[model samples]
Target: MKAGYVIRDQERPHFITITVVDWIDIFTRKNYREIISNCFRFCIKNKGMILYGYVIMSNHIHLIVQSRDGKLSDLIRDFKKFTANQILAALHNEPESRREWILERFAKATETHTRNKNFQVWQYGNHAEEIFSLKFMWNKLNYIHLNPVRSGIVEKAIHYIDSSARNYADEKGVLDITLAENPVTDTRKNSEFWKYNSYED
Candidate 1:
Protein backbone atom coordinates (compact mmCIF):
# COMPACT_ATOMS: atom_id res chain seq x y z
CA MET A 1 0.00 0.00 0.00
CA LYS A 2 1.18 3.57 -0.65
CA ALA A 3 1.90 5.83 2.37
CA GLY A 4 -0.84 8.34 1.60
CA TYR A 5 -3.47 5.64 1.00
CA VAL A 6 -3.04 4.04 4.41
CA ILE A 7 -5.90 4.43 6.86
CA ARG A 8 -4.47 6.46 9.74
CA ASP A 9 -7.63 7.39 11.65
CA GLN A 10 -9.73 4.25 11.87
CA GLU A 11 -12.56 5.99 13.69
CA ARG A 12 -12.88 8.88 11.25
CA PRO A 13 -14.79 8.54 8.01
CA HIS A 14 -12.61 7.85 4.97
CA PHE A 15 -13.24 7.86 1.26
CA ILE A 16 -12.20 4.46 -0.09
CA THR A 17 -11.91 2.87 -3.51
CA ILE A 18 -11.73 -0.91 -3.98
CA THR A 19 -11.02 -2.11 -7.47
CA VAL A 20 -11.37 -5.46 -9.26
CA VAL A 21 -8.24 -7.30 -10.22
CA ASP A 22 -7.02 -6.20 -13.68
CA TRP A 23 -9.93 -3.74 -13.68
CA ILE A 24 -12.22 -6.48 -15.01
CA ASP A 25 -15.87 -5.45 -15.32
CA ILE A 26 -17.33 -8.20 -13.15
CA PHE A 27 -19.93 -6.00 -11.49
CA THR A 28 -21.76 -5.41 -14.78
CA ARG A 29 -23.81 -8.43 -13.72
CA LYS A 30 -26.78 -7.84 -11.45
CA ASN A 31 -26.08 -10.83 -9.22
CA TYR A 32 -22.55 -9.66 -8.57
CA ARG A 33 -23.74 -6.16 -7.75
CA GLU A 34 -26.34 -7.60 -5.38
CA ILE A 35 -23.61 -9.52 -3.62
CA ILE A 36 -21.80 -6.27 -2.95
CA SER A 37 -24.96 -4.71 -1.56
CA ASN A 38 -25.67 -7.72 0.67
CA CYS A 39 -22.14 -7.55 2.05
CA PHE A 40 -22.59 -3.90 2.95
CA ARG A 41 -25.85 -4.72 4.70
CA PHE A 42 -24.19 -7.49 6.68
CA CYS A 43 -21.23 -5.34 7.66
CA ILE A 44 -23.41 -2.46 8.80
CA LYS A 45 -25.70 -4.72 10.81
CA ASN A 46 -23.06 -6.91 12.46
CA LYS A 47 -19.59 -5.41 12.08
CA GLY A 48 -20.06 -1.84 13.30
CA MET A 49 -19.63 -0.23 9.88
CA ILE A 50 -21.06 3.24 9.55
CA LEU A 51 -21.64 3.67 5.85
CA TYR A 52 -22.16 7.27 4.80
CA GLY A 53 -22.00 7.04 1.03
CA TYR A 54 -21.35 4.34 -1.56
CA VAL A 55 -21.49 3.67 -5.30
CA ILE A 56 -20.85 0.43 -7.20
CA MET A 57 -19.52 0.78 -10.72
CA SER A 58 -18.63 -1.81 -13.34
CA ASN A 59 -15.16 -2.52 -12.04
CA HIS A 60 -14.78 -0.58 -8.79
CA ILE A 61 -16.61 0.74 -5.74
CA HIS A 62 -16.34 4.06 -3.91
CA LEU A 63 -17.35 4.53 -0.29
CA ILE A 64 -17.36 7.04 2.54
CA VAL A 65 -17.24 4.94 5.68
CA GLN A 66 -16.20 4.83 9.33
CA SER A 67 -16.23 2.20 12.07
CA ARG A 68 -18.37 2.53 15.16
CA ASP A 69 -16.09 0.09 17.04
CA GLY A 70 -12.83 1.54 15.73
CA LYS A 71 -12.08 -1.57 13.70
CA LEU A 72 -12.49 -0.29 10.20
CA SER A 73 -9.60 -2.28 8.79
CA ASP A 74 -10.90 -5.56 10.17
CA LEU A 75 -14.35 -4.84 8.82
CA ILE A 76 -12.96 -4.12 5.37
CA ARG A 77 -10.83 -7.27 5.38
CA ASP A 78 -13.74 -9.51 6.23
CA PHE A 79 -15.89 -7.81 3.62
CA LYS A 80 -13.38 -8.42 0.85
CA LYS A 81 -12.66 -12.02 1.83
CA PHE A 82 -16.31 -13.07 2.06
CA THR A 83 -17.34 -11.16 -1.07
CA ALA A 84 -14.52 -12.68 -3.10
CA ASN A 85 -15.53 -16.21 -2.16
CA GLN A 86 -19.17 -15.53 -2.93
CA ILE A 87 -18.32 -14.00 -6.29
CA LEU A 88 -16.16 -16.95 -7.27
CA ALA A 89 -18.89 -19.36 -6.32
CA ALA A 90 -21.44 -17.37 -8.29
CA LEU A 91 -19.26 -17.44 -11.39
CA HIS A 92 -19.04 -21.21 -11.16
CA ASN A 93 -22.67 -22.02 -10.32
CA GLU A 94 -24.53 -19.11 -11.95
CA PRO A 95 -25.27 -18.72 -15.64
CA GLU A 96 -22.45 -16.58 -16.91
CA SER A 97 -21.33 -16.40 -20.55
CA ARG A 98 -17.86 -15.08 -19.69
CA ARG A 99 -17.36 -17.22 -16.60
CA GLU A 100 -14.27 -18.94 -17.91
CA TRP A 101 -12.69 -15.72 -19.10
CA ILE A 102 -13.34 -13.93 -15.84
CA LEU A 103 -12.10 -16.88 -13.79
CA GLU A 104 -8.98 -17.03 -15.93
CA ARG A 105 -8.35 -13.35 -15.26
CA PHE A 106 -8.78 -13.81 -11.52
CA ALA A 107 -6.50 -16.85 -11.57
CA LYS A 108 -3.84 -14.95 -13.48
CA ALA A 109 -4.05 -12.10 -10.98
CA THR A 110 -3.00 -14.41 -8.14
CA GLU A 111 0.20 -15.52 -9.88
CA THR A 112 2.17 -12.62 -8.35
CA HIS A 113 0.85 -13.05 -4.80
CA THR A 114 1.25 -16.01 -2.41
CA ARG A 115 -1.69 -14.99 -0.24
CA ASN A 116 -4.23 -15.85 -2.90
CA LYS A 117 -4.52 -19.60 -3.54
CA ASN A 118 -7.07 -20.21 -6.32
CA PHE A 119 -8.14 -16.71 -7.35
CA GLN A 120 -7.85 -13.03 -6.45
CA VAL A 121 -11.00 -11.02 -6.92
CA TRP A 122 -10.08 -7.63 -5.56
CA GLN A 123 -6.80 -5.84 -6.10
CA TYR A 124 -4.56 -5.10 -3.14
CA GLY A 125 -5.01 -1.92 -1.10
CA ASN A 126 -7.94 0.45 -0.88
CA HIS A 127 -7.01 3.97 -1.91
CA ALA A 128 -8.21 5.56 1.32
CA GLU A 129 -8.38 9.28 2.04
CA GLU A 130 -9.45 10.45 5.49
CA ILE A 131 -12.27 12.95 5.57
CA PHE A 132 -10.57 15.79 7.43
CA SER A 133 -13.28 18.46 7.35
CA LEU A 134 -16.92 19.07 6.46
CA LYS A 135 -15.86 20.43 3.08
CA PHE A 136 -13.80 17.36 2.37
CA MET A 137 -16.64 15.04 3.43
CA TRP A 138 -19.14 16.67 1.10
CA ASN A 139 -16.59 16.71 -1.68
CA LYS A 140 -16.11 12.95 -1.42
CA LEU A 141 -19.85 12.39 -1.16
CA ASN A 142 -20.40 14.32 -4.39
CA TYR A 143 -17.59 12.43 -6.05
CA ILE A 144 -19.15 9.10 -5.09
CA HIS A 145 -22.59 10.12 -6.31
CA LEU A 146 -21.29 11.55 -9.58
CA ASN A 147 -19.29 8.47 -10.55
CA PRO A 148 -22.16 6.76 -12.43
CA VAL A 149 -23.06 10.07 -14.01
CA ARG A 150 -19.50 10.53 -15.26
CA SER A 151 -19.61 6.98 -16.60
CA GLY A 152 -22.82 7.84 -18.53
CA ILE A 153 -24.77 5.10 -16.73
CA VAL A 154 -27.35 7.63 -15.64
CA GLU A 155 -28.24 11.21 -16.52
CA LYS A 156 -28.53 12.12 -12.83
CA ALA A 157 -26.68 10.58 -9.91
CA ILE A 158 -29.87 9.78 -8.00
CA HIS A 159 -31.16 7.72 -10.90
CA TYR A 160 -28.48 5.12 -10.26
CA ILE A 161 -30.10 2.49 -8.03
CA ASP A 162 -26.85 1.01 -6.72
CA SER A 163 -25.68 4.23 -5.07
CA SER A 164 -26.45 6.18 -1.91
CA ALA A 165 -27.43 9.11 -4.11
CA ARG A 166 -30.99 7.89 -3.82
CA ASN A 167 -30.82 7.99 -0.04
CA TYR A 168 -29.39 11.49 -0.17
CA ALA A 169 -32.26 12.48 -2.42
CA ASP A 170 -34.73 11.31 0.30
CA GLU A 171 -35.59 8.06 -1.52
CA LYS A 172 -35.05 4.60 -0.10
CA GLY A 173 -31.90 3.09 -1.57
CA VAL A 174 -31.06 -0.59 -1.86
CA LEU A 175 -28.99 -0.42 1.32
CA ASP A 176 -29.29 1.92 4.26
CA ILE A 177 -26.70 4.66 4.80
CA THR A 178 -26.14 7.15 7.57
CA LEU A 179 -26.83 10.59 6.22
CA ALA A 180 -23.86 12.89 6.77
CA GLU A 181 -24.78 16.09 8.58
CA ASN A 182 -23.03 19.42 8.22
CA PRO A 183 -21.05 20.21 11.35
CA VAL A 184 -20.23 23.74 10.31
CA THR A 185 -21.33 26.51 12.63
CA ASP A 186 -22.51 29.97 11.57
CA THR A 187 -19.26 31.73 12.38
CA ARG A 188 -17.91 34.23 9.89
CA LYS A 189 -14.87 32.10 9.08
CA ASN A 190 -16.92 28.92 8.63
CA SER A 191 -19.44 30.92 6.60
CA GLU A 192 -16.71 32.01 4.26
CA PHE A 193 -15.42 28.43 4.03
CA TRP A 194 -18.85 27.04 3.12
CA LYS A 195 -19.42 29.85 0.63
CA TYR A 196 -16.21 29.02 -1.18
CA ASN A 197 -16.24 25.23 -0.86
CA SER A 198 -19.86 24.06 -0.93
CA TYR A 199 -20.20 21.15 -3.33
CA GLU A 200 -23.21 20.62 -5.62
CA ASP A 201 -23.99 17.55 -7.69
Candidate 2:
Protein backbone atom coordinates (compact mmCIF):
# COMPACT_ATOMS: atom_id res chain seq x y z
CA MET A 1 0.00 0.00 0.00
CA LYS A 2 2.27 2.74 -1.21
CA ALA A 3 1.17 6.34 -0.63
CA GLY A 4 1.19 7.09 -4.34
CA TYR A 5 -1.15 4.21 -5.13
CA VAL A 6 -3.73 5.00 -2.48
CA ILE A 7 -7.06 6.41 -3.64
CA ARG A 8 -7.06 10.04 -2.50
CA ASP A 9 -10.00 11.61 -4.33
CA GLN A 10 -13.13 9.55 -3.98
CA GLU A 11 -15.04 11.42 -6.66
CA ARG A 12 -12.44 11.23 -9.41
CA PRO A 13 -12.03 8.22 -11.67
CA HIS A 14 -8.99 6.03 -10.99
CA PHE A 15 -7.38 3.14 -12.79
CA ILE A 16 -7.08 0.20 -10.44
CA THR A 17 -5.55 -3.24 -10.54
CA ILE A 18 -6.75 -5.96 -8.18
CA THR A 19 -4.75 -9.16 -8.18
CA VAL A 20 -5.41 -12.58 -6.72
CA VAL A 21 -3.30 -13.73 -3.82
CA ASP A 22 -0.16 -15.44 -5.11
CA TRP A 23 -1.29 -14.61 -8.65
CA ILE A 24 -3.49 -17.66 -8.81
CA ASP A 25 -5.24 -18.28 -12.07
CA ILE A 26 -8.62 -18.64 -10.40
CA PHE A 27 -10.56 -16.68 -12.99
CA THR A 28 -9.77 -19.15 -15.78
CA ARG A 29 -13.10 -20.76 -14.99
CA LYS A 30 -16.31 -19.24 -16.24
CA ASN A 31 -18.02 -19.50 -12.86
CA TYR A 32 -15.28 -17.53 -11.14
CA ARG A 33 -15.39 -14.85 -13.83
CA GLU A 34 -19.16 -14.65 -13.51
CA ILE A 35 -18.80 -14.01 -9.80
CA ILE A 36 -16.66 -10.96 -10.55
CA SER A 37 -19.14 -9.71 -13.13
CA ASN A 38 -22.02 -10.09 -10.74
CA CYS A 39 -20.11 -8.19 -8.04
CA PHE A 40 -19.44 -5.33 -10.44
CA ARG A 41 -23.11 -5.18 -11.39
CA PHE A 42 -24.08 -5.13 -7.73
CA CYS A 43 -21.68 -2.27 -7.01
CA ILE A 44 -22.88 -0.28 -10.00
CA LYS A 45 -26.53 -0.71 -9.06
CA ASN A 46 -26.28 -0.41 -5.30
CA LYS A 47 -22.88 0.87 -4.14
CA GLY A 48 -22.55 4.10 -6.14
CA MET A 49 -19.73 2.68 -8.25
CA ILE A 50 -19.34 4.23 -11.66
CA LEU A 51 -17.41 1.63 -13.66
CA TYR A 52 -16.03 3.13 -16.82
CA GLY A 53 -13.79 0.33 -18.09
CA TYR A 54 -12.66 -3.09 -16.94
CA VAL A 55 -10.95 -6.30 -17.98
CA ILE A 56 -10.75 -9.54 -16.03
CA MET A 57 -7.63 -11.57 -16.60
CA SER A 58 -6.72 -15.02 -15.32
CA ASN A 59 -4.93 -13.76 -12.20
CA HIS A 60 -6.05 -10.12 -11.89
CA ILE A 61 -8.42 -7.45 -13.13
CA HIS A 62 -8.06 -3.81 -14.16
CA LEU A 63 -10.72 -1.13 -13.81
CA ILE A 64 -11.26 2.54 -14.41
CA VAL A 65 -13.86 3.60 -11.89
CA GLN A 66 -15.34 6.44 -9.82
CA SER A 67 -17.85 6.77 -7.01
CA ARG A 68 -21.08 8.66 -7.54
CA ASP A 69 -21.49 9.24 -3.81
CA GLY A 70 -17.80 9.99 -3.23
CA LYS A 71 -17.05 6.85 -1.27
CA LEU A 72 -14.80 4.92 -3.57
CA SER A 73 -12.68 3.44 -0.79
CA ASP A 74 -15.68 1.99 0.99
CA LEU A 75 -17.12 0.62 -2.24
CA ILE A 76 -13.82 -1.10 -3.06
CA ARG A 77 -13.52 -2.57 0.42
CA ASP A 78 -17.03 -4.02 0.31
CA PHE A 79 -16.55 -5.37 -3.17
CA LYS A 80 -13.38 -7.23 -2.14
CA LYS A 81 -14.89 -8.63 1.04
CA PHE A 82 -18.06 -9.88 -0.63
CA THR A 83 -16.30 -11.31 -3.66
CA ALA A 84 -13.72 -13.11 -1.53
CA ASN A 85 -16.41 -14.85 0.53
CA GLN A 86 -18.40 -15.85 -2.54
CA ILE A 87 -15.34 -17.19 -4.30
CA LEU A 88 -14.24 -19.15 -1.26
CA ALA A 89 -17.73 -20.63 -0.87
CA ALA A 90 -17.81 -21.56 -4.54
CA LEU A 91 -14.49 -23.39 -4.20
CA HIS A 92 -15.91 -25.44 -1.37
CA ASN A 93 -19.25 -26.24 -3.02
CA GLU A 94 -18.23 -26.59 -6.64
CA PRO A 95 -16.50 -29.46 -8.41
CA GLU A 96 -13.04 -28.01 -8.73
CA SER A 97 -10.10 -30.34 -9.30
CA ARG A 98 -7.69 -27.77 -7.94
CA ARG A 99 -9.83 -26.93 -4.95
CA GLU A 100 -7.44 -28.20 -2.34
CA TRP A 101 -4.46 -26.49 -3.93
CA ILE A 102 -6.18 -23.19 -4.31
CA LEU A 103 -7.61 -23.25 -0.80
CA GLU A 104 -4.22 -24.11 0.64
CA ARG A 105 -2.69 -21.13 -1.11
CA PHE A 106 -5.38 -18.82 0.15
CA ALA A 107 -4.93 -20.11 3.68
CA LYS A 108 -1.21 -19.73 3.48
CA ALA A 109 -1.65 -16.13 2.39
CA THR A 110 -3.46 -15.34 5.64
CA GLU A 111 -0.68 -16.74 7.84
CA THR A 112 1.15 -13.39 7.88
CA HIS A 113 -1.97 -11.36 8.61
CA THR A 114 -4.11 -11.87 11.72
CA ARG A 115 -6.96 -9.86 10.25
CA ASN A 116 -7.96 -12.73 7.96
CA LYS A 117 -9.95 -15.35 9.84
CA ASN A 118 -9.17 -18.28 7.54
CA PHE A 119 -8.17 -17.37 4.03
CA GLN A 120 -7.09 -14.46 1.91
CA VAL A 121 -8.30 -14.41 -1.67
CA TRP A 122 -7.19 -11.06 -3.03
CA GLN A 123 -3.82 -9.32 -2.70
CA TYR A 124 -4.13 -6.20 -0.57
CA GLY A 125 -4.03 -2.69 -2.05
CA ASN A 126 -5.60 -1.97 -5.46
CA HIS A 127 -2.60 -0.02 -6.87
CA ALA A 128 -4.97 2.81 -7.65
CA GLU A 129 -3.75 5.52 -10.01
CA GLU A 130 -5.96 8.54 -10.36
CA ILE A 131 -6.89 9.63 -13.87
CA PHE A 132 -5.66 13.22 -13.95
CA SER A 133 -6.15 14.22 -17.56
CA LEU A 134 -8.20 13.22 -20.58
CA LYS A 135 -5.14 11.72 -22.27
CA PHE A 136 -4.34 9.70 -19.17
CA MET A 137 -7.94 8.49 -19.02
CA TRP A 138 -7.82 7.24 -22.60
CA ASN A 139 -4.41 5.67 -21.95
CA LYS A 140 -5.79 3.68 -19.04
CA LEU A 141 -8.91 2.70 -20.99
CA ASN A 142 -6.82 1.40 -23.87
CA TYR A 143 -4.54 -0.41 -21.44
CA ILE A 144 -7.47 -2.15 -19.78
CA HIS A 145 -8.98 -3.18 -23.12
CA LEU A 146 -5.72 -4.42 -24.60
CA ASN A 147 -4.51 -6.37 -21.56
CA PRO A 148 -5.87 -9.66 -22.91
CA VAL A 149 -4.27 -9.03 -26.24
CA ARG A 150 -0.95 -8.22 -24.60
CA SER A 151 -1.20 -11.43 -22.62
CA GLY A 152 -1.76 -13.48 -25.79
CA ILE A 153 -5.26 -14.47 -24.69
CA VAL A 154 -6.97 -12.81 -27.65
CA GLU A 155 -5.87 -11.47 -31.03
CA LYS A 156 -8.15 -8.48 -30.90
CA ALA A 157 -9.20 -6.74 -27.70
CA ILE A 158 -12.89 -6.93 -28.62
CA HIS A 159 -12.66 -10.73 -28.86
CA TYR A 160 -12.21 -10.94 -25.11
CA ILE A 161 -15.59 -11.60 -23.51
CA ASP A 162 -14.54 -10.59 -20.02
CA SER A 163 -13.51 -7.06 -20.97
CA SER A 164 -15.29 -3.74 -21.67
CA ALA A 165 -13.51 -3.63 -25.03
CA ARG A 166 -16.50 -5.35 -26.59
CA ASN A 167 -18.78 -2.67 -25.25
CA TYR A 168 -16.56 0.03 -26.71
CA ALA A 169 -16.65 -1.87 -30.01
CA ASP A 170 -20.47 -1.73 -30.04
CA GLU A 171 -20.83 -5.31 -28.77
CA LYS A 172 -22.41 -6.46 -25.54
CA GLY A 173 -19.94 -7.21 -22.75
CA VAL A 174 -20.42 -9.41 -19.69
CA LEU A 175 -21.15 -6.38 -17.52
CA ASP A 176 -22.23 -2.87 -18.40
CA ILE A 177 -19.72 0.02 -18.19
CA THR A 178 -19.82 3.77 -18.58
CA LEU A 179 -18.23 4.32 -21.97
CA ALA A 180 -15.53 6.99 -21.77
CA GLU A 181 -15.18 9.51 -24.54
CA ASN A 182 -12.09 9.22 -26.76
CA PRO A 183 -10.06 12.18 -25.61
CA VAL A 184 -7.22 11.66 -28.05
CA THR A 185 -9.43 12.55 -30.98
CA ASP A 186 -10.86 15.52 -29.14
CA THR A 187 -7.41 16.71 -28.12
CA ARG A 188 -6.14 16.49 -31.68
CA LYS A 189 -9.09 18.51 -32.95
CA ASN A 190 -8.63 21.12 -30.25
CA SER A 191 -4.95 21.45 -31.01
CA GLU A 192 -5.64 21.94 -34.70
CA PHE A 193 -8.33 24.54 -34.00
CA TRP A 194 -6.03 26.56 -31.76
CA LYS A 195 -2.84 26.11 -33.79
CA TYR A 196 -3.13 29.38 -35.73
CA ASN A 197 -5.42 31.35 -33.40
CA SER A 198 -2.91 32.32 -30.70
CA TYR A 199 -2.90 35.96 -29.52
CA GLU A 200 0.41 37.67 -30.38
CA ASP A 201 1.81 41.09 -29.57
C-alpha RMSD of each candidate structure in angstroms: 4.3, 7.3
lDDT value, candidate 1, whole model = 0.87
lDDT for each residue of candidate 2 in 7-111, tens digit (9 for 90 to 100): 999899999999999999999999999999999999999988999899999999999999999988998899899999999999999999999999999999999
Give all candidates' CA lDDT scores: 0.87, 0.87
lDDT of candidate 1 over 79-142, digit per residue (tens): 8999999999999999999999999999999898799998999999999999998788877887
TM-score of every model versus the real structure: 0.90, 0.91
In model 2, the runs with Cα more than 4 Å from the true position are 186-201
What pairs collide in candidate 2? none
- Estimate the lDDT of model 2: 0.87
Task: Assess the local accuracy of residue 102 in candidate 1 as a C-alpha lDDT between 0 and 100.
Answer: 96
Candidate no. 2 TM-score: 0.91
